[model samples]
Target chain A: MADTDKSPDSSRRSERSRRAILDASLALVGEVGYNKLTIEAIAARAGVGKQTIYRWWPSKAAVLLEASMALSGDAEDEGEWTGFPDTGDIAADLKHVLRLTVDQFNDEKYEAPARALTAAGAIDRELGEKFTRQLLEPALVLYENRLRAAQAAGQIDADIDVRIAVEMIVGPLTHRWLQRTNPLTHDFADTCVDQVLRGIAPR
Target chain B: MADTDKSPDSSRRSERSRRAILDASLALVGEVGYNKLTIEAIAARAGVGKQTIYRWWPSKAAVLLEASMALSGDAEDEGEWTGFPDTGDIAADLKHVLRLTVDQFNDEKYEAPARALTAAGAIDRELGEKFTRQLLEPALVLYENRLRAAQAAGQIDADIDVRIAVEMIVGPLTHRWLQRTNPLTHDFADTCVDQVLRGIAPR
Candidate 1:
């Protein structure tokens, strides 16, 4: 394509336009919400042509997801996105990751975009699946690996399905975040860890 | 108000108008989605005057909530809205209720409106809080009571907070439903109950 003209100046300009578009998308979605937000508005706000947005992102949802990821700086570097940590203690590791999640949810930059993305996911199934696969599932696999280590150490039952078990760890935290039912905190995260470790009921 | 004329004919007409308005709201929300839905369109489709809608419900979100509740038939009869059943087995009772939830999530009538409502809730905090208070909290209380019974029966630890423990039971089910990550099923609900009962790892 003519746009693929390989030149240092062109590459720098491309990067600048991309950043502008993402920034504009995030700001507009926060102000007007995802449903009313339009490609034209994003282009105008970004000081780029409408064609620039259309060329890079297929939909507003696409722009929002990329912008969210960029703003959070979590998935920007694929190499740095190295799953959850394993400090040898399953409970400690899980708590550590959950606390980070709580922090992310609490951050103002991430909150509005994340909320918009979640609402978009609920209404638009195809976009929902794409982002979930692109973003959520990879993180879940990390939990699965951590649980596997615990099973091998005999801290957990070997027979338990780690995939399902992982949900128990993450579900409550995400539920509270999405529903706004309660204040998410490190204390809440620690509670989830402790409860899962010994079970909610008595042995 | 002038419409408060207490006559059988007027009351019958009022009931007809209410039903029509609700039906129109649900159908329109499903077709055009919550963002595009308006009182004008709802009135036009319901074949009722716009004043008929404004006289009863304050906004589209209010109308949608009432219509959704009516469609689900869960909160229709206050007296019949008994809490979760107690079959003497805590696990069995929880599983039964969750399976019914799975069924509701699967139903077409519930699915579309519910999707719209959740998206609405995410963007509209005022509406979200209102519906959560009026709808979700009541059901959660039922779970709270059930867990307390389990605690009383010595099935659960007396010290375990029923409020948090209840989230462990319902969270995964809701997380899955909201994300559309998996098909919500009786089997999935049963797995959650079984996993929670015994804990994910060995005791």
Candidate 2:
């Protein structure tokens, strides 16, 4: 309604504004941190009105979560979306997926916003739960499915809990990421895959 | 020098003040979060002068770190600090230690301040590194030593890196704690211990 332009033109403009807002949100969060980041600042940086932000998102946390999702979407587009890579070899498949995870973690686009959301998620339980369910759970489900496949193939113990087993593979890499203890490398990914499979395979 | 009273009375009063300041810092961080928490507010709530807080700790992070350390000290007093119990059963010992960790994480005294520091540390690299070194590394070293003992006993692969092996044990619990996905329970602890030991035991 605000636009004098046609429907397609208006839609394109709206998409541009949305991208700008998300980019600004990520940049500001990286520079100042999640706690100090404000919608007004995001609006200023994006050259959009505060009303434009509020119209699209409920809170700063919501905005950041969207920005994070956008980053994840871009990574998925970069060949990381190939789910679980079930090529009959569970270890190689897992290593492939985890190596891509390491790449995603190390990507400059993903780093700042992910860091911001994680910090915000720590104190704000509601936001944490929302992001976890919407963002994290879906990714974990892919792991769960892959593990289930491995179980069916007899590569893993029939008694192994796929959910917890998935945690074994994902947990260390996530710990390293959140703790910033070391570089999240392909080598580290390979090690995690090796250890986790060794744990779940029949004695 | 500032106290009118001398020796025993002054020392007792100083100790009381320190405890009060720590309590105030924890309470404020829980209520307002780490970003909003201020030393001025801590001093006011503790019924001490600003100078009193400054004399004891260098910064707000330092105060929270001390408070967090105090909670850790209390947990240690509850017999959790007894190190990895070597009953020759590495699985049982690691599970026992991890169970104690679940208890400490569940304790109310540790929750708020711990959450505050984690959130703060996510954005503030210096605080993260300081706490990681001072608080986290010591606990990790205990696990490392226990794994070394297991290696010597021929219970574990001598070639396994204790550093990454330790993460196999610690990472999942930490992930559960920070993510607040589920109750950090004895059963969870046992599962992690079983899975990790299975991974590192000689094939």
Top DockQ hit: 2
For every candidate structure, what is the RMSD over all alpha carbons to the true structure, in angstroms? 3.1, 2.3
Give the number of the best model, judged by TM-score: 2
Model 2: runs farther than 4 Å from truth? A1-6, B1-6
Tell me which residue pairs clash in candidate 1: A157-B202
Against the reference, the lDDT scores of all candidates come to 0.79, 0.84
lDDT of model 2 at position A183: 76
- The per-residue C-alpha lDDT of model 2 at residue B48 equals 97
Residue lDDT tens for model 2, A101-141: 88767876677777778778878889888888888888889
**What does the lDDT read for residue A156 in candidate 2?**
94
* lDDT tens digits, residue span A9-95, model 1: 998898899999999888888778877899999999999999988888888878887887676464435343445787788888888
- Give the candidate number with the greatest lDDT: 2
lDDT score at residue A180, model 2, on the 0-100 scale = 69
